[model samples]
Target: MPRLSLALSLLAVLVPAAYAQEAAPATSPKITVDPRAIVDSMPQQGTLLTGLYATQATIELCSVEAGEPATTAMNAHRRQLESEMRMDDATSAAAYAAIKGDVEKAGVDCAEGSKDRQQTAEVIAIYSGAGATPAQPASPMDPAAPAPSATPADPAAPATPATPAQ
Candidate 1:
């Protein structure tokens, strides 16, 4: 009888311990993204709002080819844009469509080895915050800091070199 009670107590304790081990939640690897890198990589010539919209299109299109990390980054960035920009559903949809149409019109192809694919990869790297150097603050006293120039700025226009500071 004593042996039977000891066996029952051991069984009760051991079973629950084993079950608790099995029921414990699994930990997943953490993902980190650098906001500064993402912001620095935005198209500098346009209004920041327009650049963010275009970035959204880029992330959506490239994520199809770029896979999981891009998708994760895309979701994070999209949420940030929607919240920070205060985009209503209709406005967000319209902006996405317009920017995506413009990108397609510009012949962006996400296929392997294409120039567009390379650009997309670069953009994804920025979004992924992988191997991205931290952006240095611009200082007026720092000669290495980029000087302001008389540059024409337009969202739809092709990029042109800024005039050299005299």
Candidate 2:
């Protein structure tokens, strides 16, 4: 019985292959998806979702140097994208997976780091809903880093200098 079943299955496969070979001038149209078509047909906020995927993919690629900021940025983007996409956790996760697949299939690399906070066109084109990037570490020489207070510490000082020493 096993042998018969095996033979039938082989015959079934072969018959279809043979018929397919004879049936068309064109080879089977590759069932490939067009990145543009996929992006264009997405529902509102889909682009942002794709951007989220791009960000995740980029962060993963940059994992060797990924720091707290990158992680925070990725998380924040995810939350916003989730809210905008209006999907439950599981569904949003699946949607992100699909976006990753589509972006990868289109040969867009998401792993490169930005000197500045601006996202790449490929990322933006697919999803422009990113409100902000994560905060990077304060540079040692960066003026943005707060300077130490000029005033000397005095625990006994009054609550306010404006008030008399009461």
Candidate 3:
């Protein structure tokens, strides 16, 4: 009977530790999220996407370090970037492009941290509205429209034109 009780106690103490270990990884952060859902659901498409990307990256880094819950880390990251960057849809779009480049570079940096990866202009093409450079703002004032002359054209200057070269 003593042996049975000792076995039960051992199980009680060790089972929880084993269960705790099983749950340990869950506590760590997650990098990937349902980006599409977030993007589609957000009222501000541009800002959310950018913010999401930045948050994901931050969560990944934090997870790699502190091993906190991914969702917690993700929320913290989103708040941090939103506050620190003060980004709107337009700004967020711009930022996402930049962040994507940085994160890609980070991967290489982690592996080699030596050689420089040269990025070409083609690789960094900016896709503004409609995948075309945002239509040059239709100049409000027409270029063809004549601009007013500064000097009240020396009307006399032209008239003195032919002092008949006497």
Leading candidate by lDDT:
1
Badly placed stretches (over 4 Å) of model 1 are 1-64, 132-166
Q: Model 1 Cα RMSD, Å?
A: 22.3
For each predicted model, how many residue pairs clash, with residues at least 3 apart or on different chains? 0, 2, 2
Model 3's alpha-carbon lDDT is 0.51
Model 2 Cα RMSD, Å?
A: 23.6
Q: What TM-score, to 2 decimals, does candidate 1 have?
A: 0.43
Tens-digit lDDT track for model 1 on 19-102? Answer: 998999888989999766646454432244565556557656766455567668767767676667677889878877888889
Q: Candidate 1 at residue 104, lDDT?
A: 70
lDDT of 3 by residue, 75-158 (tens): 565556655656676875666668767776666332222222111111112111112233245454977555677765676675
Q: Which stretches of candidate 3 lie over 4 Å from their true place?
A: 1-68, 105-166
Q: What is the TM-score of each candidate against the true structure?
A: 0.43, 0.38, 0.23
Predicted structure with the largest TM-score when compared to the true one: 1
**Residue by residue across 72-144, what tens digits does model 2's lDDT show?**
6657777876887677989977876777676567665434454312354334333334434434877879887
| Residue 164 lDDT (model 2) | 67
Cα shift from native, residue 149, model 2 (Å):
31
Note the residue pairs that clash in candidate 3: 29-70, 30-70
Q: Candidate 2 vs candidate 3: which has greater TM-score?
A: 2
Candidate 2 deviant stretches above 4 angstroms:
1-44, 61-64, 108-166
